[model samples]
Target: MQTPLQFCPRCKKDVAFVAAAGARTCPECGFQYAVSEPPNPGSFPDRPDRAGNPWLQFLTIAGIVVLALLGAGALLLGILFVGCALAFRG
Candidate 1:
């Protein structure tokens, strides 16, 4: 059996190519059909683990150091408050 020719949605005429290659331009009405893949509906892991760039690694380390310094400062403040309370009690 012969395959039926695919019709262009705009002009209702047979399309040139079977698989939508490039833009589908309608000869009759000059309507342009945009050729794009359908979106993948399934969720998938976007990130893959690998050795990152050296500059990126350095920035990440710098961020970690800043966070650690903030945590240390909070701990030091708590210790100073406790020591001040003990000294006042004496």
Candidate 2:
């Protein structure tokens, strides 16, 4: 019986899958197809092992720093205003 041809990376061409001894193989190069399913294309690994976008992280951190600086500036200005008011009240 004939089978559909699958591309063989080792053989660099499409070849028929030959079934023998319960395993499918490339006819020309004798490359065996794995029984297990391959991983999906462009899939992410576990969170710890996966890489995230560096630019997004950098922007998030930068935004937080800017907000924090603004908060600190407002706090300092409030303190200065309170001190000046007290000094002139005497």
Candidate 3:
């Protein structure tokens, strides 16, 4: 039986879901499968969306830290300029 078309990451095209062995099999490469069952199916999806991705979280925190550092540096520079102007004022 054929189901609605799903996004195929490998094939990079929408393909109908082919129910085989209680998993969604890829109709193109025939290698990847999306096992939507339990009891140790032991198969992974073609396009894995890992929610708890450590690398992604780490990169996001790193980006925020970098932006914070840049803002602090700019603030320090402005304070130094203002202090220098006040000291040299006649």
Candidate 4:
């Protein structure tokens, strides 16, 4: 079921509604018209699903913290081991 075309305000030409566009230009006179939906009492278009998952958010933060701590610990251990080796050699 296709929606009806809207009339161009400038030239009164019929302009079809584009799904992703807000306004369309008239083919006849190049006049722009705002796309409007037909009045339906109980019509709901497909809406984007909410990206709401509590566990996913918690796991992402935990993973970042673990990686940061591991990286810092590894760096500190490397520095300490190298310093101890150099001191013993001297």
Candidate 5:
């Protein structure tokens, strides 16, 4: 049995597909493609752990800060509108 040759996008040539150690590499330009193993549904983890991802935490904190600032601005505007209305009435 022989594996079908695939077109190499980088080299722009037809090359034989070779697989070794869960990866496919192009012979011409050395382009690598990782072969992903299918996850076992029964053994899957309950939840993804994001504690190690600091960027996501930073983004979440930044979003909360922005929302808080926007709420403060809206409250300030409301207070100013009430003050202007009271002044105009008097």
Candidate 6:
């Protein structure tokens, strides 16, 4: 089903509600809007599930931390390898 269009307060333009719900960004003015109850009831033809899951949020943070640590470790190892090569050459 297609979602109805909504009016953007900043741009005074009719923007697609489905696109705004997914991105929370206004197509015209680039203004950001929160995905919550519409200011006027029935403004949005349909509501998309915007529920947050705690486990997913935790895993996302954990994944980012793991990636950062791995990147740092790789950088340190690269520096050490270069230093060892230069020292042995001297």
Highest TM-score against the true fold, candidate = 6
Clashes of 5: 0
Model 4 TM: 0.45
Q: Count the backbone clashes (under 3 Å) in each candidate.
A: 0, 0, 0, 0, 0, 0
For each candidate in turn, the TM-score is: 0.39, 0.45, 0.44, 0.45, 0.45, 0.46
**Candidate 6 Cα outliers beyond 4 Å, as residue runs:** 1-50
Error at 13, model 1, angstroms: 34
Candidate 3 lDDT: 0.73
Error of 2 at 72 (Å): 0.5
Tens-digit lDDT track of model 5 for 1-90 = 455688989998999867666577899899988756433354533342453468999999999999999999999999999999999999
Q: How much is the lDDT of residue 27 in candidate 5? A: 90
Q: Write the per-residue lDDT of candidate 3 for residues 10-88, one digit (tens) a residue.
A: 8888887566665677787664675655423565344344444779979999999999999999999999999999999
lDDT string, candidate 2, 1-90, tens digits: 345567888888988776544356887878987634334446523441223567877888999999999999999999999999999997
lDDT of candidate 6 at residue 3, scale 0 to 100 = 56
Taking the tens digit of each residue's C-alpha lDDT, what string does model 4 give over 1-90? 464577767766676634435555666677654546443346534431223456877998999999999999999999999999999999
lDDT tens string, model 1, 8-44? 7777778553323445466566777665534234542
Which of 1 and 2 is the better model by lDDT?
2
lDDT top scorer = 5
For model 2, which pairs clash?
A: none
Root mean square deviation (Cα) for candidate 3: 7.5
| For model 3, the run of ten residues with the poorest summed lDDT | 38-47
Model 2 score (lDDT): 0.72
Cα lDDT for residue 62, model 1?
Answer: 100
